[model samples]
Target chain A: MEQSSCTVVDAQETFSRAREQTLIESVKGGDTLAYHELYDAHVKRVYALCYRLTGDKALAEDATQEVFIQLWRKISNFTGQSRFSTWLHSVAANVTVSYMRKQRGWFQRMFSIDESEAQYHAAPADAHSIDLEALIVRLPERARMVFVLHAIEGYRHEDIASMLGMAVGSSKAQFHRARQLLKAWMGYDED
Target chain B: MTKTNFDDALKQQLDTLPEEKHPERDLWRGVALALENEADTSTAKPGWRSGWAAMAASVALIAMVSWYSLQQPSGPTEPSAITGEALVQALSQQHEQQKQALLVEYTDTPALADNWQQQLDELDDAAAAIKAALAEDPDNPALLRMLQNVYQQQITLIERVHAPKWQRI
Candidate 1:
């Protein structure tokens, strides 16, 4: 019975992938309806990544829109070397970062404004009830970005460094900083 | 929480994180609009080239308008000589004829921008405002100039977005 169930699961996975590949081909052929279907399939995952990276609902929404717009233009570039979800995530990360940079003022970009400290707000009524997502959002900008990219998104420190224009050491340090902050917010005792 | 316990808890939370999150509002509309705009432009020309063409057209229109304005009378004129209402009506008629001709010329060609109609509507609003101001000051050359400029912009926009690919070449 177990062996038969395993075979069924494998068969389902194969069917799902084949369907996705067909959908991708249809979208690349300039079928707007097929593109809409593709968007519906992946938008939630894209939106989640955007929201986690930006930590703002409205910014996430805008970034999601920009990502889809870019995807429509560049869908032909996907060679199917990797899973489509993986390619889409990379696109979302890059687009979100670029969108955030464009939203910043020239002065901020030029001056390299320090955003290392968390933006303060009233604490949750019960500290123990605070969720990990809330704590992640309270992290500083660079640390939050590094944490989301490296820890959650499973990007290597090297790739994170390149994406954020930082040294690998800096990316590692930011990840550590983010972990420490999250632990503290969660009421963990330091070793 | 102990360090070991915290590590375990963090790992569990990370593992359990939801893979999907839906936005409060539907974002498909904005994406569709943008894609439609891109398709409109990219079908006949590359997006970057279309952008450049639009910019060049704008500059040419500005230069022509400046040169023409320089040759015209600057001072206020008699209302009876050329009333603002009559000027608006004449310009509107000329604009409509030119617009129709351009539309017929490009009837088979796809537009270079999806929002061209929206842009025309916005220009129409501006012309109406200028018309209202001209009602109070029928002989204001400045008002007349503004009205003429708006009309010219409408015509320029139409010509730029609907220019056939052969002309671009």
Candidate 2:
């Protein structure tokens, strides 16, 4: 029965992929209805990613719009070498990171994590319950970017380094830095 | 409070993070308006290029028709030129006009990367620098490649936001 159920699940997944692929093709042809359907199917996941990366609700909203706009423009560039979800995640990451970087001034970026943290606008606090998304936003800029990408998004440190244009060591360092900061935020940095 | 280790707790929370989160607002309306605007602006082409644009359109139509027949019955398949239709037909004229339209449309759209305009301007400024260098050594292959790369980047920046395609897929 377990083996039969597994086969049924796999078949369902294959069916879903084929349907998604069809919808994607329709979207490529300027089919707004198809695009709308496609958007409906994926919007929440994309928005979540945007919010996680941008840290601000408004920015996430704008970035979400930009990601779909980009999708409308570059869906053709998606060769399907990767799953559509994976590919969209990559695009969302690029768009969100680029958006954040653009918000920062050239001189304010990444020479050191401490300096960037000073510029970072930490999230607002609550009296009793700490906010998860806000905690992420409160993280230092470089460390925040690294932590979100590495811990949450599952990107390798090397990949994070390349995306942020920092050394691989810097990416790893930022990840550790983020962990400590998050711990402190959670009232756990007892040492 | 139960003693949950920070790393373990955080890891578990992060791992269990849902794949989806509904935005507080509807974004489709904005996206739809943008798409509508692009289609309207493109169809209502600015004058000047309408001259040779006729020739370009004719060429693109013929190529698209050929490519369309070959496309799988599954929706709208990409044209023969996978990079783009213009790339497929080698119709630089049509591509240039489309590229310009996109550049104009996305001109005010803010780029999120730092020094976004500065970087684009730097690429443009490098064009002048290339021109000045060419005054000394006219046939340098490296400079030639740089010039091509710069133009391509400009198109990429523009199309990165507003390149349109036509197909069933």
Candidate 3:
């Protein structure tokens, strides 16, 4: 008899187990190569996060590298208390936001009164092509990061709170604010 | 434009992102090499023990290099400023120190060691470009600092990998 196809649940389980195990061993064997493999697997996703956070490709690229560079410099502290991906996103969010603060004028460049009004109506189809990715770039720094982690990347408000050094409710509120902004920009009603 | 309507539209958009964008494998290999160099030294552990040690080493390394650069007094005056991007890129090269722990954290697959020596050479080229840029504008403190950092990081990585007793593997 033919074997049944692997279910989504099974695949997820297999992948997670494999990933977790790989990390555990690499850490044990003193394999820096393993450390980078993990970084490589996730750099683009992290870059997408930074790009959305900064809305400037060059700045985002810097922030993206900083996130991994920080991770590489600090991965020895990754206690398996929480999921590795969760911790990684937390670092990505914080680093991007901090870098954005230093950048000084990103908000106005992307969302000034004139640009918002202009982009609102004729938002291109390609706008949503990188849905979570593109929607993120349009968000203000804090809200963009909150929404990226909670709504898109799927972290809980509590986890976001801890990672970002904010209150849990605030994390929830920011996520909502981000969604509202995205809706408004994308031609959605506030309610 | 309604809330529900927006959610539908946004959901549809979110679902459309391409599953993957194949990285320039060649470039990624270089990045991988750097990460390996960062993680190469140190014992692996569950949490911050190893990380803290690495951070301490990095800070010390940076400080030492900065001190050494300053001590040269005759090297260059009016250190040029570098773009923030270049500063971060320079820091990104110590891949040797952090790769091993990452391997343990993600254990199943073997970590691939790429052509790190080639990446180091690429870094020299990049550093030369940055230095040339700084030469044109020597008054920029930021660029000057970055040039110093890049120069030091490249020298250190080269020294570490090419040390008399060490092999690339």
lDDT by residue (tens digit), candidate 3, B47-76: 223432343345445544654565554655
lDDT of 2 by residue, B1-169 (tens): 2235766767676777778989988787688668756655685422112312332343334434533454435555333423332232243354457657876777776432222354445555655555454445444334434445555655664543233221112
Residue-level error in angstroms, candidate 2, position A1: 5.0
Write candidate 2's Cα lDDT for A1-191 as tens digits: 99999999999999999999988876765555567778888999999888877667898999998889878888989899999999999998998777767766634765544653432444334324655566777776678889889988899999998898889999999888887776666666455
DockQ of each: 0.25, 0.21, 0.12
TM-score of chain A, predicted model 3, versus the true chain A, to 2 decimals: 0.63
Candidate 1 C-alpha lDDT tens digits along B75-135: 6555565565776678778888987887788788766456677767767776776678668
Clashes of each: 0, 8, 51
Please identify model 2 stretches exceeding 4 Å from their true place: A1-8, A104-131, A189-191, B1-4, B43-169
Better of 1 and 3 by TM-score: 1
C-alpha lDDT (0 to 100) for residue B102 of candidate 3? 41
Off by over 4 Å in 3: A1-3, A7-16, A27-29, A81-83, A101-132, A155-177, A189-191, B15-169
State the local distance difference test value for candidate 1: 0.76
TM-score: the better of candidates 1 and 2: 1
Retained native contacts per candidate, as fractions?
A: 0.66, 0.53, 0.25
Which digits, one per residue and each the tens of the lDDT, describe model 1 over residues A75-107? Answer: 899999999999999999999888877887524
Model 1 vs. true fold: TM = 0.62
